[model samples]
Target: MAIDEVLADLKQKIDEKLPKGTTISSVEFEGPQLVMYTENPWSFADNGNIVRNLAKTLRTRIVVRPDPKVLVPPEESVNKIVETVPVDSAIANYHFDPDVGEVIIEAEKPGLVIGKHGETLREITKKIGWTPKVVRAPPISSRTVKNIREFMKTNHKERKEILKTVGRKIHRECTSKDQWVRVTSLGGCKEVGRSCFLLSTPESCVMIDCGVNVGSEEHMTPYLYVPEVSPFSKLDAVVITHAHLDHQGLLPLLYRYGFEGPVYCTPPTRDLMALLQLDYIDVASKEGGRPPYSSADVREVLKHSIVLDYEEVTDIAPDIKLTFHNAGHILGSAISHFHIGDGLHNVVFTGDFKYEKTRLFDPAVNKFPRVESVVMESTYGGVNALQPSLQDAEGHMQQVIKNTLQNKGIVLIPAFAVGRSQEVMIVLEDAIRKGLIDNVPVYLDGMIWEATAIHATYPEYLNNDLRKLIFQKGENPFLSECFRPVDSNELRQEIISKREPCVILATSGMMNAGPVMEYFKAFAEDERNTLVFVGYQADGTLGRRIQKGWKEIPLKTGKGTEMIHMNMNVEIIDGFSGHSDRRQLMEYIRKMKPRPERVFTEHGDERSCIDLATSIHKKNKMETRALTNLETIRLV
Candidate 1:
């Protein structure tokens, strides 16, 4: 029976025995059963018998254990696994159930039976239709450490032979000595926006993260414009790093051009890109210009995506192995890793990464199997990009909010719809719950709320701490009752004009475009409201201009310049950035088990890449190449 029905049945029986004016204060699920606490005034005999009768009636085992916290599943009458896979020489013992599936292993050496990749056990389960678990065989007291060594030796030998067969098959399908694998970033070379990278191999071609140049162009176009359709026609996949437009805006245009392949991403990215692409179309339409692509085109693109897990290695082509790892930049953002040939020329591309753990996601994992070369980004490569500690950053944000609330003015945070918006919400929620700030309405005005919802769907991809905190403590920090998602324009205007102390988190953190611009234009002259920046503001963006002490900004409406005389405070918090800083990058390289022979740096300006290359060469005594777009470097 369902849990709700079981609870209802228990409630009905309890209410029949209780008198009027009595109340059941609590009903909780304890280990092995349900427990109900009441404010009744009587202690009746046969209470234990009544509870036993309730269990019988519900068809579920229930016991009133002393602690009331011991809940366990009811015992079954039969040994299910033995019925199918009988105790034979191949199997020492078997225990199986419908829910958890079957487990068969060797009594002496379970590790040897399972094989290194669990190939032996997994194959059995696949054939038998039951889940298999290899027992961790404990060492006998007589042998102790010696027994462990012997068992592991046997296990390694058996597992290696089994894996060798499987590896041979995989190798045959994914090796190309004559094939070419080259990635060129035509744009997004200097700054964080206009992210476009080209990947070409003999067997397949792909481009990951084709976004627009928000920092430079008045109207951003997809990076796919840089490559002709003939090159893209041979493409096998176009993987998006995340849903942020700079990472995913020009996806639909791929279909418009005539590229049709599986758009691989995590499930949350698939859902978020749907909403974001539609918004992109709407925004472009409102501007009375040629929109990038139609909504139907985006749907078509989404339909072809094959959502996979973080480390699932799948073949995009006959000779290409692709896997996604958590990048910790935004919800569903991934660092693409390619194991391309028999030589295992492993290549790791950090689409955008956060080396430090954040509220919702874990830091990027730097370990890989012999990474030949790394294509890294240096958005914050300049000496000025170094960030303060997380505590200091959060403290400044809290102070800004407190000061703005004291003045009874709204605080606007123009954050990116993905990572920045989520980080700000997490900090704000914690601050509010701890009574650090007054209870004020936190309005989510742009695509921020939708993005938050997407992040919630995939908690496993987040940091280990976040996963534990979410699952164990039952905390949904992003979906707190304090946040109000504003959708309608009328409601947004009403909230903005209320003259109350509140927080407004909008999209387009750069102030290049999106709802943040509208809020800034409305609140810039107030002198009471404060605009807090929680992310990097690229040069030429309104956020950057304001940060540089620009007194006035040219309005998009072309009316005139708007003077910012408002007491509007500007504060920047840096720990939330997704990229690793200079120190972190160097430390990561130093820790690699097998140091790379050659390191090529791209995704940053000419100066930053050269500086990084120079540093790596001087320190590690290795060849470091500062790569330029369209310039190909031969490996091997």
Candidate 2:
């Protein structure tokens, strides 16, 4: 049915189901939900089956809100909430969105605020006309979380309008019934950076991941200029798989252009990606050049964003239903599952998935209700991509640090701020506790510290062991006292000049930019100092070049490019990556609940993609193929 028809049908149903003497003022679509303004909102509280029957009949979520005039003042409601909710809940923030009649309550212990069986929430809703939406704030107070909340509160009116606009677009009627689906790779197919792909059918157009190629300074972005998603005028929706720069870095560019569709993602991903997007702009501005989009574009993206929890099925387009599964990579990272058409097709895109368990998170989810064609990342898919055992890798890491410390030289570990950095933190913390290495002050950069803070917010998403240590055991390795944050570059310089024997974990794991480069430039000439890599360094990157034994390389300086000698010891410990290696990759396919019919590989070097595809086809005989950018595949 068309959007107008759906709305009319819902209105008629509401009229038929509402109790006598109850009147509705208006009805509208708020994204995927149906919100109705009724004078008899009390009846909804009294009748349980009324809403149950309506929701089942409409096959869409519904919310019955009170008329505008019935709401109590915000200040009065705040006092009531404070008096009603227990102090143990530790309410972090509370505000009322007048436009939506929602009382947003953020607390450290959301369970306490919810009471037993959500009695507290219902009490608040019944007392005041405003609905209570209790959210569990991150255990660690994150500046990124604060910034997003403030933005929404400050521009509630604008955010409301944006949601209404998106709701209409999602419910738009389909114009065709062609039961064929195809995928077009815009970028990140044959190589690892600038990852993007267009999933299109006769009824809808969706992009799985839209990100830029930061390593390629030459082609440092995705092919957004193509006619299909160009100007992004015809795009229905965009689903983000993770918060890494390669997966969600170029999202603002969509808003900067003309794409006004909603970006579906998990809550943790929304916050983490916002943090990265803001940091990207800050880095670009510091380099004396403008980024592709401005802060306004980013704000627009946030306003248009609709967060869905893992396994919570949501409709993104007329024909596409989305479900997020835990992708054991980072906080809020998810494997994107799109159930398209009326069971006509199902596609599972493992966006940078890690099939094996890590200290930070559980392994990526392999079971699904249905999967026909699977798009998997092949970062470590080559024959030689086998990783050393975790025990061996940790031992080697400790030995490297031990050697550097014994030489009275500082050690620098370059890691991606999101996943690798946190994983290494656990390794280092555990080593120190076990007395595997001498105790040293482990320095953390701003990005690492902030990213760790984001991780602390949602402990439930982490691995079983880590989550137990955090929520149940009350012992978070990330909060270890030995860890010191390098708040500024001047502080970093001071630490180096002091020449103290310490370890530093910094960002841009590839040493592309950020605090990692600063530390690398300062320590590269020192033969005693060591640079350890615990993450993947893509091709065309400085880290890759150094790993390939580049004695010296030219780097951009304030005045001109200067050659930086690589005298410091550079070592790579292979098992600490968040992405699955060759062994884990094959095991993931082998253990899939219902194995996929066809597999396409991307997000790796050309050789890895081909090698992995060949192995899968030869072993499983699943009609696997290696894909490249701009390649199109039809699945019917």
The Cα local distance difference test for each model comes to: 0.65, 0.86
Candidate 1 lDDT (Cα, 0 to 1): 0.65
Model 2 residue 411 lDDT score: 94
lDDT of 2 by residue, 363-398 (tens): 899999999989999999999999988788989999
Model 2 lDDT at residue 299: 91
lDDT of 1 at 435: 95
lDDT of 2 at 119: 75
lDDT of 1 by residue, 1-636 (tens): 444554576678766755456445444443223455443312211133555565566533332221212212123212333333334323444443332222334343444555555454444433343445544322212122223224333354443343333222222333345756676665566545667666666555667777876566653554444543255556667778777777788878888878655677876677677777788788778766678789878766654566667886665544667788888788788878777755547677777777777777887767766677677767655445577777888888898899889987889998888778878788889999999988899999788776776566556667888777765675768768889988799988887676678999998878867788778877887777898887877667788888898776766575656454544777776776666777766666666546767776765667777777777778898888776654555453
TM-scores of all predicted structures: 0.71, 0.95
Maximum-lDDT candidate: 2
Each model's RMSD to truth, in Å? 19.4, 2.2
Off by over 4 Å in 1: 1-180, 218-231, 558-567
Q: Name the lDDT value of residue 333 in candidate 2.
A: 88
